[model samples]
Target: MNCEQIRELLAGYQDGELDGAQHEMVSGHLEECADCRAELAQLDKVKEVTGKVKYNDLPLEVWEGYWQGIYRRIERGLGWIFASVGAVIMLITGAYYLVKDYFMDPAVALFPKIGVGALIIGGGFLLVSVGRERIFAHNRDRYKEVQR
Candidate 1:
């Protein structure tokens, strides 16, 4: 067999997938061709090491429940998102009306108005600080790129 044919069939020969005629032809070529023999040797060593490698096998039930677990987590996440959005909307609406009324009322005390303004500013600063911290933490998370 020529070098091109031998190279094409090399993997099949190594895996014992070649028929009797093809196997004999490849064997004869390997005996006379030093390059093909060396290549075959490398392929054999790789196959030997890979063959000895073992995989961790989980139970059948674990595999069956895997999708269910993922689905439940996604469901819970969506529910929490909806609930949180609704709560934020209500809080923002309430705060907007309260602040509007406070500012519009000329009879309201100045000290109380200042206190309310300080509280709003403090809450905004806290929210921004927490959001920035969370973004930095997520960027630094080592397993963030890992597949679930």
Candidate 2:
């Protein structure tokens, strides 16, 4: 076989993947060609160096930081979720009582009831608008990572 063909199979031959005929052909070429022999030697050195490559590990602080970030995100997310749920439940109950007891009373004057209803509606809209704005700003806050 030519040097190029034999060199192509050199890795396979080194790993004992070549059949007897192929092995003998490569051996014959390596014996006669100094260039092929040099190539085989270089391949052997590369295989040795790569086989000895070791795995490196990150430092303790890196792992600690990773875990801390994860825990903080989970803790804050759950806290906010639980607090919002509780507040919503209380708001619903209070709203129900206000509507049933105050708004439904026949003795209540029309003007006062209309004023209170308008105040509650405006407050609800303001609360929703502020909450949405806060969430939008929080998501896009470019300087949130800046330390004081």
Candidate 3:
């Protein structure tokens, strides 16, 4: 195997994932290639160090405390959800009357005025979007010319 092939297989070889034939090929290559040998040595050192490192074990009391914290958060989250639902119901009820009193009335009204204002704002936004697109396209063409 070439150096690149050996390097690609080196990680799997170190992890004992290679078959016997593949292992032999890598071993043969490592023997002949100084670079692959050095790489394998480095991988072996990393595996050795990682294998020797110790992990801290959590106690049962710690696990209980973690669950307690999670339960408290869940309770608080549920409370917020209920409060938000209540607020939304209140807003819908309040808005119903306000909209009826202000807009649905056939007398001197604000609905047509608000509708015209919204149309004007929407038109302005459309113009701004088109202008931005044109500006970006022009800048992009200039940048391409500079790159060339």
Which residue pairs clash in candidate 1? none
Local accuracy of candidate 2 as per-residue lDDT tens digits, 1-148: 7888999999998888999999999999899999999998999999887765522234566688778978987997899799999989998998999999999998998899999999999999999999999788866662474341
Q: After superposition, how far is residue 16 of candidate 1 from its true place, in Å?
A: 45
Order the numbered candidates by TM-score, best leading: 2, 1, 3
Please name the candidate that would achieve the greatest lDDT relative to the true structure.
Answer: 2
> Considering every candidate listed, which one attains the maximal TM-score?
2
Overall lDDT per candidate, in order of appearance:
0.84, 0.86, 0.80
Q: Give the Cα-based TM-score of candidate 2 against the true structure.
A: 0.55
Q: What TM-score would each prediction reach against the true structure?
A: 0.45, 0.55, 0.36
Comparison by lDDT, 2 against 3, better one: 2
Higher-lDDT candidate among 1 and 3? 1
Candidate 3, residue 112: lDDT: 81
Q: Write the per-residue lDDT of candidate 1 for residues 14-127, one digit (tens) a residue.
A: 989999999999999999999999999999998877765522234655666777768876996798689879979987998888878886688999999999889988998998
Looking at candidate 3, what is the lDDT of residue 126?
95
Reference-based lDDT, residue 100, model 3: 76
